[model samples]
Target: MTAHIPQSRFAPAEVVTRPQPGTAPTDRRPLWTVIALTAALTGLIMAGYVLTIGTWTVWAVVAMALITLTTLTLSLGAATAVVGLIFPAPRAPRPMPDWQPSSRTAILLTLCGEPPRGPAAMLAELAADLQRAGLDRFVDIFVISDTRDDKAKAEAEALAPLIGSGAITYRRRQENVGRKPGNISDWLDRWGGDYDFMLPLDADSRMSARRIRHLIHRMERSPSTGLLQSGMRLLPAETRFGQLQRSAQRIMGPTFLQGFSAWTGDAGNYWGHNALIRVRAFRDAVPLPKLSGVAPFGGDVLSHDFVEAAWMRRAGWRIEIDADTRASAEDGPQTLAEYHKRDRRWCQGNLQHLRLIAAPGLHPLSRLHMAVGVMGYLSAPLWLATLLLLATGAVPMAAGWMLLAVATLLAAPKLCGVARLMRQARGLRTKGVVLRAAALETVLSSILAPIVMVNHVVDVAQVFAGRDCGWKRPGGASLRLPTGGLEALAGTGIIALVAATNPSAVVWVLPVALPLVFAPLFIRFMEAPCACLMARA
Candidate 1:
C-alpha cells in the first residue's frame, strides 16, 4: 500500500530523468487478446502430447510421471500460500530505543566488481538520509572494493576524494581472497575494533535514515545478537519491465517471504549482503572452509553467506530477521537480460548448496534451508520436462492423471496469490483493473515458463563448469519479444491432438483448450513490467 514516487527521503534517493512516452495503456487490450489466444492454442498442443502417450511407451510414461508429479507439488504449494500477508521474519530484532546511540557505528559498503560511481551515489544518498535523521556523526562508513578489473581499480582510486572527505574509509586489496566474505574479513582484521557495529550494504542498496536509525538503536539495546537481517524486496526502475517486476513482487512477494521466514526458525541467516552483522562474531568465524576441491562444489564457496550463518549459529550466536526492518531497498535487475543473467548466477550459487547441506557441523535444519533455495530454480527444469513429455503419444489415461496432479499442485500458490491481489485491488477500487491484470499474467507467465526454464538449466550447468558470470560487459541479441506464441501453440496443439484420440476427452479439452489458445500472448504480456507500466501510464 505504501507506494513511492521518484526517490524520496526514505525512498531510493536517486532519480533519473523521465522517459518519453511510447505505448499508451489503452493499447494494451490487444496484448491481452494475444495472450488469451496463445493460451488456447497451447492447451491444444499439451492435449496432443497426452494422447500420444500409451501403455507401450515406457520412457514417455516416465517423463509424464515426473512432469505430472512435479506440477502437482507446485500446485499444492500454491494452494496453501495466502496471497497478501506473507513476509519472512528472520527473528524479531531487539526493540529499537528512542534514545540516540552512545557508541560509534561503522557502516561497511562492500564493493566488488560493481560500477565505481555506483557506491558514491549510494553513499551520498545514505549520507543525506542519515543527516536528515540527525544521526550522521554517530556513524562512520567504509567502501570496501575488491577489484580484479583495471577499470574498477581506477574508479576506486578516483573515489579517493570521497575517502579524504572522511565520509567513508576506502580500501582496495591487491588480490581478491574469498570474494565478499574475504572483503569483510579484511576490513574487520584491520580496523573492526574502531566501531561498535559494522553494517554491510550492497552495491545497489540505498536505505532510509529512519530505518538506519532504528537498526542502530536496536543494536545499542541488545549487545548479545550477532546479526540482524532486514527484509529485502525488488525495486526495478522506470522501464515497462521494471514496473511489472516491482508490481508482481509487491503483490505476490509477501507469500514467498512468509514461507521463507517460517522455515528459518531461531538460528536464521545473514544473507551476506543487505544485512547488519556483529563485527566480533564475523571475525571469530574467520578462515571459512573452502568448498572441496571440485568443479561446481569446489573452489571458493559461492554460497558463503549461508555457510557463515551456519558457522555463527554453531558459535552460540543468534541470527534473526527484523520483518519490520525496511531500512533499505535494492535496485533489481534493470533490464530483462540483466534479470535472467543474474538469475543464472544465483541458480549456480544456490545449486552448489545442495552439496554442503550434509556438511559436518551444519545445523540439522540448515540443510533444509539450503535445499529449499536449490529446489526453487530446479523446479523450472522439472516443469519444462513435464511439458515436453506430454507431447509424445502414449497412454492417455495415466498421462491425463499425471498432468492434472502436476498442474494442480504447481499452480496452487499462484492461484492463491491471484485471490490476494484481487481483494487488495478491489479494496482500492481497482478491482476491474486487478482482475484483468491477473488473467493476463496467468496466461502469459505460463507460456514464458519454457524460455525461463531453459535459461535456468543453462545457468545450473555454468555453475558446475565454474564459468564466471561476473562483469558488466555487453552482448548482442536480436530485438525480439519472447517466442511466446509459437511455443504455446505447439505445446497446446500436442495436448489437443491427444484429447482428440478419445471421444470423451473432446468435451473435457474445452476446459483447458481456451487458455492454451491464449498461452503465447499471455507469456508476452506476462512481462509484468510492460503491463504494469502501461496500466500506470
Candidate 2:
C-alpha cells in the first residue's frame, strides 16, 4: 500500500484515507532467457576480439582475457551478495525519533546562471511541501546567487520580500570566488557550521519538504551516517521525451539504489543534495581541494561529489547510499541544447577521474564504479566506431563475424543488467507499463546514443588529447526553455532502428537501447508522475 495523497503545505488536500491496492505486478519472463542472451553476447564479443587480433595466438590471449573478466565479475558479485547476506543491514528501529528540531533545517539554494525560473519556483515548491511535513519552523532557507550580472542580482533582490523575513536568506556576492564548489566551500567555511542538517539544493533539483524531513529523521535515528543521498526524480512534464526518461529512471533507480546501498551498507556515501547530512562530519571530512589550474576539471574536482565521498571514505567514516530512500527530486536539461551543455561538463568531470582510477583509498567497488562511469560514456563512441568500421566493406568477412561476435560481448552486461533489474522487480504487475516505456526509450536512445557517444568521447578524447573543450553554457533559464527538437528527432530515429530487437529471446532485452537515445528527452520531463511513485518506489 502506498500514499496516494502526497503531503503538500502550499496546497494540502485533506488526507483522504483511501486504499489503492495495486494489481499483482506482472510476471516478468524467465531468468534463463536473459542468461542465454548473455552467453550469446559473450560468444559474440570473443568472436570480435579474435577477429580484431589478426593471429590465432592473440585470439588465444583474448579468449583468456574474456574468461578472466567473466570470472572476476561473477566472483565479485557472489562475494558481495554473500557479504550482504551474512551481515544484513538493520532497518530503521521503531519510533524513529521525531528529530524535527525547532532549530530549523536550512534549504541552501545555490545558483550560477539563472536557469529556468531562478531557483525560486523550485525553492517555493520544495519549501511549501517541506512546511506541510511539519517542518516550516525548523526550516531556514537561503538562495545563494553567484551571478555577477547586475540584472540577475536585482532580480534576486526582488525575490527577497517573497522569501519572508529570516525564513529565507538571499546572499549575492559582488566577486564570485569559488565557482559552484568554491561557493559551497566558502559557505561551509563561513555559515554551514550553524545548521544541524543542511539540505543542499542545486539549481535544477526539487523535492518534497516531507522528503527532506524523512532524510533528517533517518539521520537523527542513525547517528553514525554522515550523509544521505536521496533517490533522485526528474521534474517538469514538458515534452513526451522527458516523461519517458523520468518514468524509466523512477522505476529502476530505486532498485539500483537498493542494490548499491546494500553493497555499501557500512561504507555509505552521499550525492551532494536531495538528502540530509550531518553538517559537522561533512565540514570536517569533505573540503574543496585547493586545486590550482584552469576551469572545469582543473580547478577543484569537476566531479566534487565522488571526490568528497572518497575523502569521507578515506577518513574511515562509512558514506552509504540508501537506494530505497526517497528524499529528493531534480530535473534534467529540458532541450537538446541544454542536454549537451550538461553533457560537456559531465565529460570533463568524469574524465578527470583517470588520475584517481588507480587511487589508493576508496573501496575497490567505488573505484570500479568510477571507472565504469567513465567507460559508460566513452564506450559508446568506441562501440559506434567499431560498428561503423565493421559495417563498411573495409574488413574481411571473417573479420566481420569476429567483430559482430566482439560486439555481442559488449551487449552481455547490459542484458544481464536488465535481467537483474527485472528480477529485483519481481512480481511487477506493471510489466506491460514498464516494458512499453522501456521499448519507447530503447528506440529513442539508439539514435541519440551515437551522438552522445561521439559527443562525450570527443570531449573526453580532447581532454585526454590535451585539447581545450571551451565551456559554453547553453539555453538561459526561462518559463519556457527550448524543447523537443534534436533530442526527440534523434531519440525517435534511434529507437526506430533498434525496435527490431523488441520481441527477442528476452522480453526486457529491448531496454538496452532505451535510456541512451531518450535520456535527453525522457529525463527532462517527469513521466507518469503517479505511476512513477508506485512501480518506481
lDDT of each: 0.58, 0.53
How well is each residue in 1-537 modelled by candidate 1, as lDDT tens digits? 111111111221133332221221122232233234334434443465576555546766676556544543353244225311343233534444456776566788877667778778778777767777677867767777776656665665657666656556677777777778788887777667665577888888766777777776665555556677767776546555565556566555656445434434345676766667766667766557776766455676676788787777666555655545255677776454677767865676678787778877776646655765787787766655554444333333444555564455445556656666665564555876666666655554554455556556556656655665543212323114344444345446746674655444444344344444554565444444454434552
Candidate 2 lDDT over 1-537, as tens digits, reads 110121212221223322221122211221233234345545555554555654445334534454435433433333333333233334643334465553335677777666536466666666667567667866667776676655564555556554544446666666676566677776666566556667788877777765666666666655566667777767644545455456556544544454445655555555666656666667767764644566444664776677677666565544656554454677765455566676776677777777666767676656765665566466655554443332332222233444334334433333433544465564666555555555555555444454465456546655665543445532222214234334345444444543443222122222323444455554444232334433332
* The candidate that achieves the highest TM-score relative to the unseen native structure: 1
lDDT of 2 at 27: 18
Provide the clashing-pair count of each candidate structure. 77, 37
Cα RMSDs, all models: 12.5, 11.5
The C-alpha local distance difference test score for the whole of candidate 1 amounts to 0.58
Candidate 2 runs further than 4 Å off? 1-54, 57-99, 102-104, 116-118, 291-297, 325-327, 388-431, 470-537
TM accuracy, model 1: 0.72
